[model samples]
Target: MNIDRDARLEKPVITANMTPLQWANTEKYWTLYKKESRISSESDRTTHSLTCCDQELRDQLFSIHDDIFEMNDVNMLKRIKNMAVKSESVIVAQVNLVRSRQNPEEPIRSYYARLKGQAVICVYTVTKK
Candidate 1:
């Protein structure tokens, strides 16, 4: 399917404060949209992805990074993911993970899955020192 200007496709808006899982979901959704819409052109994909991002995110990218407008879709998405995993956001994710709990009526499997999702944002590493 060539680019359909009239297609009622809702793009996923990426935000500056989005968590790792949220970012992953956004990327997945974008991929699905591309596949479903049969959008193969790199330029079209990049333009659509960037246009879906929130204003703050777009501004931040434009300010700190040069040649973003020339970037391909994969590179631009990678840059956005990197920005989201900064120190401040990681700290916030750790705090959220620490405070996470299952709701009263939630099942064990669902609770476990939720906790796992929350944990994805809290980067874990082992120091060789």
Candidate 2:
């Protein structure tokens, strides 16, 4: 799945102010792109992952991290994910999820899928008692 060619896999430019849901969507698309493209090599995956972001984000990554160039795809993703998620943003995501509702004309399956997608933004940490 070429990011440019596929609408579902289009590259999302990660900005500092982007909402948690937006970041989740971006990550979801990136994962889909990786799966569909079958990029197996760590080097190739890292290259593609780095290129998927906009130049601004790339510049920010470079500026913030000294070893970005030396990082693999998983580490790069972790870095980006850390930048994207925040405590306040998690509350916002929860609010958005709570506000989400199906349109009157929307099918149940589509509505359910949409809710599921929105739920991704509301990350919950599970702890065993």
Candidate 3:
């Protein structure tokens, strides 16, 4: 299963609650995304269903395509929170699983950032091995 010589390259892409325009509200937002550096990973955390209201977020979780969406609890939905998506020295990444379907009981990784008034989520999911 040596994957290093696949002769394929993945195009670099970014993700957020809505579109690139929506994520660029401030320099801080860009900085935040740079930290996470992946679109699907960021979407799983900060947005309900990887989208806000009516905006259709990029479905980077799947190589094919999906419209899977998730929502926060009423409490999390109503509160103001700061969010950041990135990898860290201690953590490899924020969102590990961005798939077309998920079990409701599956645990998704997320963090509460107070400044952005939202929880940073990483729906790192595992499939049947």
Candidate 4:
């Protein structure tokens, strides 16, 4: 397996995902490879499938790739539609908490400021589409 000493050195080639790549090889991993012969690890399955993704998809995925183990695609999709991707979920949840609160005893200016900050956070988190 150690061919480095005898192998010829060549220039490395960098390939970019210029074209759209769909997840078309699921059958190979799910049915063929792991059907009975071997059990594939979570990391192996994730990396293998990601290799077929386009650049845009890969970049979007990279942010939460490490947290892939805890990711729920259904919930993630809903968050994305709301423009609350990743850390923005905190702001959204906070806004809901504030909105549910009854009138609190506070100065008029401070109360308005709090509401305004929450408004801004909500506006940005909501996706137009």
Candidate 5:
């Protein structure tokens, strides 16, 4: 069978569920959202990026407000933020521990060993990059 394809058919169709007002606002929000500051920390960046998706769009995306995907995303973001804050505290503690002087009664070998271990842990666990 031979059929003539209308050129208009090549264009995208607006989804029936989304209204014109919602679409316009979403487009405007997206443009403004992209101009926001870029974060250096991975966790901060993730939080910032996720927040850019406006609530209106989110409501349109998931029929249920308590959708599993939404819940998981929120939980993951919270975990990332917590990890970043905790890692910062850990790094500071390790630095202080490494800097403290050994007691007069402590052996020089033991002091060096403790410092080396702390240094290794800091280097492996709290990398900023």
Candidate 6:
């Protein structure tokens, strides 16, 4: 997917449900995703992680993955999960949306972790498919 000169290039299909802020957050992160996709071409470790986890774990991971960096000081996977669990939010549905760069068939899952009063989202990676 050479996206250098094609301004009208069709964005890949994805199944994701995100709020305005979450969508904006993803917009910022997409720059990193695009760079990684271009440099590695096919090295989507995070995407693979999301794809491989069982639906249950994938749902759990998605909620934490999306806003981990913002929620926590460090990006430790374990700590991120712990942070999510501590929030007491029920893991919600998986979103159906494609990464802007490498559009995979399994749209990355976007989980909405809604606690007693609020919901925060995150996109879980499929470390490998």
- Writing each residue's lDDT as its tens digit, candidate 5 over 26-89 gives 4444434433332355465444534544464344444433442434434543432332222434
Q: What local lDDT does model 4 show for residue 65?
A: 51
Over the stretch 40-119, how does candidate 2's per-residue lDDT look in tens digits? 89988878887866677778888899998788998988887676555356678689889988899999999998887777
**Which candidate wins on lDDT?**
1
lDDT of 4: 0.42
Candidate 5 deviant stretches above 4 angstroms: 1-90, 124-129
- What does the lDDT read for residue 70 in candidate 3? 39
Q: What is the C-alpha lDDT of each candidate?
A: 0.80, 0.75, 0.32, 0.42, 0.45, 0.37
User: Which candidate number has the best TM-score?
Assistant: 1
- Itemize residue pairs with steric clashes in candidate 2: none
- What TM-score number comes out for model 5? 0.26
| Higher-lDDT candidate of 3 and 4 | 4
**Predicted candidate 4 versus true structure: per-residue lDDT over 48-100, tens digit per residue:** 34443445555666675566445453443332222222234545646674665
User: Model 1, 12-84: lDDT tens per residue?
Assistant: 7888777568776787888878887778999998888788778888888889889998999999888887765
Candidate 4: count the clashes. 0
lDDT of 6 by residue, 1-129 (tens): 565653542322222333434443444454454564442433353343233234555565556567633432223323323422323222432232222232354333422222211323334445776
User: Which has the higher lDDT value, candidate number 3 or candidate number 5?
Assistant: 5
For residue 56, model 2's alpha carbon misses the true position, in angstroms, by 0.9
The C-alpha stretches of model 6 lying farther than 4 A from their native spots are 1-43, 68-129
Best-to-worst lDDT order: 1, 2, 5, 4, 6, 3
Per-residue error for 55 in candidate 5, Å, reads: 45
Clashing pairs in 5: none
In model 2, the runs with Cα more than 4 Å from the true position are: 1-16, 84-91, 103-110, 124-129
* C-alpha RMSD in Å of predicted model 4 compared with the true structure: 19.4
Clashes of each: 0, 0, 17, 0, 0, 23
